[model samples]
Target: MPYKPQSEPGKTAYQPDVQITRLGEKIGDPVVPADFPHHILRFRNDRWDQSIGLHSLNDEEWLSHFGKFEPLADNLYPPLALRYHGHQFRQYNPEIGDGRGFLFAQMRDHEKRLMDLGTKGSGTTPWSRTGDGRLTLKGAVREILATEMLEALGVNTSKTFSVVETGEELSRGDEPSPTRSAVMTRLNHGHIRIGTFQRIAYEKNEALMLQLVEYCLEQYYGGVQTDDPAAELFAKVAQEVAKLAGAYMTAGFVHGVLNTDNINITGESFDYGPWRFTPYWEPGFTAAYFDHEGLYCFARQPEALHWNLAQLASALRLIADSEPLVAALEGFPKAYGTAFTQHFCWRLGVESRGFDEDRDLVVAAEKGLAEKTIQIDRFFFDWGRAENLAGLDENYAAFSEFSTLIADRERSRQPVSSYWQQSGPCSMHIEEVESIWDAIADDDNWKILSKKINDIRAMGIALRIG
Candidate 1:
């Protein structure tokens, strides 16, 4: 019998929307999935899968689709090697595109929002500039940890959908050679990046650029209701990206590579690599070691994101007027300020007052944190559970204003989970991540990684993070 999913009453059946190819063949090249030596199903995310019902699929079926790259019932027949040029480390690189990953499938989420199932380390493609298209098992593990911790902290991110260890040993410079290898699939809003527009703009195809802008509006920003849809879409994207950036700050996350290609048009954080959570609010702290300039450090993320938005606006200028796009770019600071206040308050388990008052509270917290060498996550976790800065008598005076600011503010309706009290905090510091990966490399032990995911999910559920 064909695999059939019974839909819940009044809910739509799980359907695949093959919309990417509709953008025309010029957008991407059809490619085949690599024939891997092994198809070991490692991880599967069944959250928000009410309609797709992945939790019901057995191991063999999971491997068939995600591992063997077999098509879902009515999804894409052949995956697409998406084409886009990016500014790698602020240097324009037109020669690079989806070197390893490809768009595997497209579907709608429970909220009727369009979602994509994309891959990394699935195979080589036309865009594989000069490398074997493979993701290290360690890289896959790190991404799982990064996405899990980010999601638990309420940052909008790509879900690490599945990981399958290919029976292949690969050599690499960054880490140990002859290490294990794996392929990962992520469920995200879309694979469309700021670089996507850069590519179209580079070709000087104004008509195609206009078409691409409209297509993005239709697919992602359908709520942009202004008569000038192009500029409004830019503004919408600006606000979303701003929210994401501030969320990263409040979450103590440093997205090591904030390049054009790494930035999603939807403003959701994805393509995690060399990401880290700060032990404290050190503005100059960097994530990627190669980022010698500290270009995408903790404090510079807003700047980096704003710069990327400028690039997007520059590309949009090929189709839309420059004035409105510039105006949209100008909204970044205000958007980021508003977002930081809200996210900071939410993380501390307090309700936000007006923007200025809320921002003042955040400033106080950061100012105190700056003086002390404390982990930001601990402060957040402690505040969430106890609703007071009870410990750290030595640092009490400096940080007490944080308590004062929230004295008049009521707590949020969301209850802090007991997990916050039990588990210290779920942080993906490089040391801890390496420890987990070490266990896998040395002993092939996955229990730690599995428990960490559960613990992160438990924290998310405990906080009722929506």
Candidate 2:
């Protein structure tokens, strides 16, 4: 059986009631499943999270979420309309929009946080460029797992709402010869990106730019007023980005590609591509196989973020001074440092005064383990067993079977070590290391460590722990 695409995207003849809203357009309609080629999971009548617990709806019943159930009903969409611009892969292409993605609507979660309902791989749009604008089944599977894994690791990221596999085929050069696509329903506060601002900046569209700044103030920076919106907006965006920079470094995850377009204007991790969790710290390590220059390498993320922030500042120059913008960038390292240190303490299960020598011992032990090629996840999982890890030397032998998938020579190393201590200063104190090890030796600590790893897997991402 061959693949066939929808005759017309966003237009459901069978369910004419399912509304359609274009990106940047005043939110028009809710996205109904049956209206597209998606397979429904139906609502679980007894569930805690309404949007998350939804089972695919029957074809006849799917129109309810889209405001199509009743005529002239107000569509359940996000209140804040977004405006942004950016270059893709360093190329100045200003024609991009939500493309195949859209904000289905916004809703309050069980925790009362305002979240938006977004659709990925919905279909082709005015901004589809020269591409077929379809998402593949692999993407749905990957996104589901990414959401689960990242959340378990305590990384701030978007949540997966639903994965609708449109039984449609689309062509893409990035796929395996011919391609099949899928769509993901994601929940997030904003789908805006740093590139969005860059786009307006490149075009020198100050009018559109200020419109975007006001929108940002109302949606994300509600605490800040918009009287002199440009300077304030730039400062706020810089701060958010700085905070996010720290979050990424602490999580041991590398986004691989940090292009302005992939960078969320809301300062959150948006599109996940060529991303990998660092099992060990190698400043030069990169998640993308194609990124030979190491521009967005593990160690360079902090710097990469600064560069992106500078671009944002340049965009906001229409109304702000460069000095304040640069000053705002200074806060990132400190903020990110504090956040990372706090998270590091929790992961290590240690409650000690900041800056102890025992931290050095932990660093040394990690280096020794890495020298033996210990798997990053496994080493940490079995850190308590440092005195008893029998197969630490051969833990990663299993990965050799998948060698064809990874190009790094060290990928063949067995029992990869943890990157946790690689960046520690040379003058580490012995007491700090012992304290960390003492904490690791406790069975209670091991339990938490084991649970974190399992939780990561259950959420959908497979972590390679030695």
Candidate 3:
């Protein structure tokens, strides 16, 4: 069932705590479009809204805040476009900031965790360079799919809160010319990136760097000890990001761009662009067409993320001793390996056989799928429960020993309900995505896209149960 908008409007739980102190020139007012119409495509993530205490908002109220970019009752006025430098494609670029997006509002969730309502395709900012700061409608759709799929796969991802079709035509070289435009809002944990730190480090501002480090720990890692706070923060972020890399691998996802700017300090996945989920277990699968060197390919994601974390460590050198930072960096490999094994087991719906055996199981499963050209999602869904396995083939022999163990454990267990048993696994390959967009571009039909989202959500529920 489609989510229903709140009917009985009540007081909003708006608590804006604008923490980024250096907003002297970083903040900017949103430039309203001349003839843009706000047509809400996906209004209701009631479950997600409840988390942030936003379930009381009606349609008009939602449109007011998210669609019109109006400030919340007590939130920050004139949305702030954050300032930061980044290494784009391994090249340092100091001009990058919120060119098309800005931090619209900040609020505490039910758990009192700070969350940011950020925008994309809102309007041009001071960092808009020489290009128009508009997002194509198709790009917005792709982001919705990416976040939903990742969340279902147990990845720490941002939720696509709302999407509004801004009546505008955008010309781009990547897709069909004169594509539709949109403005999207995402509910995320934090927007602080490794590049945010690099910006402070670039100016050789040790005092500012130390302040930022303390701010991040207080906001994101409150339980972390304050003594040696900078080193502790780095280690915590490194471990979280390493787990994120593991989740990506298990889900067969390629983030496409793992630049320092895109790597969030919260270790949550956001800013989806040119992302692809592999159909088969191909290590060299690259999502971005421009990645000629395959630097951020499926197999190289861990390495890329490690390198980005190292860049973060380098930036932190301005605030802390090199010894502690190095120690934290050294923990990533173990963290990633452990997370990979655990996530792989979760996907397969099997009990982990210690770290060593679980790692062996992951390797065997990957090799088996590659040799047999087994569809990645199909392999996971069909074998999620050990009892589902029937006749084994030569390619399946690699996983037979572990399968036997799982079968023994689940011999008398009740079978869990799953969508995969009734239908093929939900996937968002390039072709299917283009076809969905083609319908929108040619016929203005949205039923197919809506159904796809529903199906993907069902699959997510099944995965969670398994």
Candidate 4:
């Protein structure tokens, strides 16, 4: 049966207030492809749709908006390919923007929080200077896995809204050549990047820079209040990004690309290009194959994010006073440390006693993992269980201090299940991902991939993560 909308179309709380694209030359406008064949709906996140009030979109409507890149009614039309410049691998690049993707639409979710539907492999844009604007099916699958796994791990991340297979062949140096093509949409809080500010700063347009800062504050930082709104916005973003950096550390995930362009103002992790989760706690782990210098390595992620936040501060300086922006940047290290400790405790399913105890627990946990050479997921899975941690070793003495705290905490709304008692926690390792793709690529089978997603979702529920 063809999927049908559970609610009325165009009856949504659709707010098409697009501020970035409204700035004419500040960003580039791009149109959707007219000839690409929209073949099949490979994936759709109806669970996420419920939160955004987009569950009413039927399959045909979904294909139209996601696969064919049709503009949402009363939303952003003639989707804009955002323009920005960034430092790639610590080297400044002047000519990089949305090459194969564009901002498709924006809306207010049920909570009235602003959300954007950004596309990948939608088609060629003005930014696609010397390359074909295309995305491989494998790449789309990887993104879906990355977002799902990260979300399950309680990391603030963009949700893979939809993935549609576009019937076309594409050649690539990475993965198999003449691979199938796909178009994907990610539902994120906002698309405003640090590079957005950097572009105006490069052009020396203080007026536009200030305007951009104001737009960001109105959209993302609506709750923030201060004498200097721009400086307050910078401080808020720095704190959010610092928390994000801490989440990455606790989750043992490397985003691979920490470029300024990839760092969004909302500090929610998006753009999963070459992301990977470490099998073990290894600081020097690098996800991208081309990252020969390990510039954005696992341990160095905090450093890279701090650097990106600094760039944002520099851009903000074109409008705001330098002292306040510098002051905002100075808070990153402390903010990251605090967030890391909290997130680490959350992963262990223990209530943190306090900052000092949490810090000591995190230190002990890391030392335990290193000494035992334990699998990251296994460690979390075992530690998350109260029963498993009831009898702790001397190595886990610090964690044992939280035993009473864990027992005293409120029980989860959901009942405990056998999923947590499994041999190992759900993980999206490279080998498993490639194996799932091999089934689809070689035999046209999606069973394994689908099952894996379901299993991952189950793990999220078992772990009490939203």
For residues 308-363, could you state the per-residue lDDT of candidate 2 as single tens digits?
87777787786567777777777767655554544443333333233333244334
The list of candidate 1 runs beyond 4 A from truth reads: 1-12, 390-392, 414-416
RMSD of each: 4.9, 14.1, 4.6, 5.2
* lDDT ranking, best first: 1, 4, 3, 2
Best by lDDT: 1
Off by over 4 Å in 4: 1-22, 388-415
- Residues 1-466 of candidate 4: C-alpha lDDT, one tens digit per residue: 1111112112344455555564666666666663576569999996777666678889998888888877777777778888898888878888888988888888777666788889899888878898889899999999999988888777888999999999999999877688999989999998888888888889899777767777788888885477787798999999889889988998899999999999999999999989899888888999999999999999999999999999988888877889988988998998888888877767766665656767776776776666545678877776676454555456555444445445555432323667766766898888998899899999999999889988987877766631
Measured by TM-score, how close is model 3 to the native structure? 0.91
Query: Tens-digit lDDT track for model 3 on 1-466?
Result: 1111112222346566666544334223344432356556553565577777777888888877777877787776667777778888899999888888888888887667788888888888877897788888899889988887888787889888888888888999987788898888998898889988888898897877777788788889985486887898999999889889999999999999999989999999999989999888888999999999999999999999999999999999987889989988988999899888888877776666667877877776776777655678877866764363475445466566556545643322123665745755788788998888888889988888888888888877776653
Decide which is better by lDDT, 2 or 3. Answer: 3
Could you tell which candidate, 3 or 4, scores higher by lDDT?
4
- Give per-candidate clash totals: 0, 37, 0, 0
Poorly placed runs, candidate 3 (over 4 Å) = 1-15, 22-43, 391-415, 418-420
Summarize candidate 1's per-residue lDDT along 1-466 as a digit string, tens digits: 1111112213346778888877788889999999999988788776644444455668898899889899988888789999999898899999888999899988876667788999999989999978899999989999999988888787888889999999999999987799899999998888999999999999988877767777778889875476776797899899889989888998899999999999999999999888888888899999998999999999999999999999999988887899999988897999889887888887777777768888899899888889865578777776676646565456456787878777677777455456755757766788988889998999989999999988888877765541
Clashing residue pairs, backbone N/CA/C < 3 A, model 1: none
What C-alpha lDDT does candidate 4 achieve relative to the native structure? 0.80
Question: What clash pairs does model 4 have?
Answer: none
Provide the overall lDDT of each model, using Cα atoms, as 2-decimal numbers. Answer: 0.83, 0.52, 0.78, 0.80
Candidate 2 off by > 4 Å: 1-48, 51-73, 76-83, 174-179, 203-208, 225-228, 352-372, 383-454, 457-466
lDDT of 4 at 404: 44
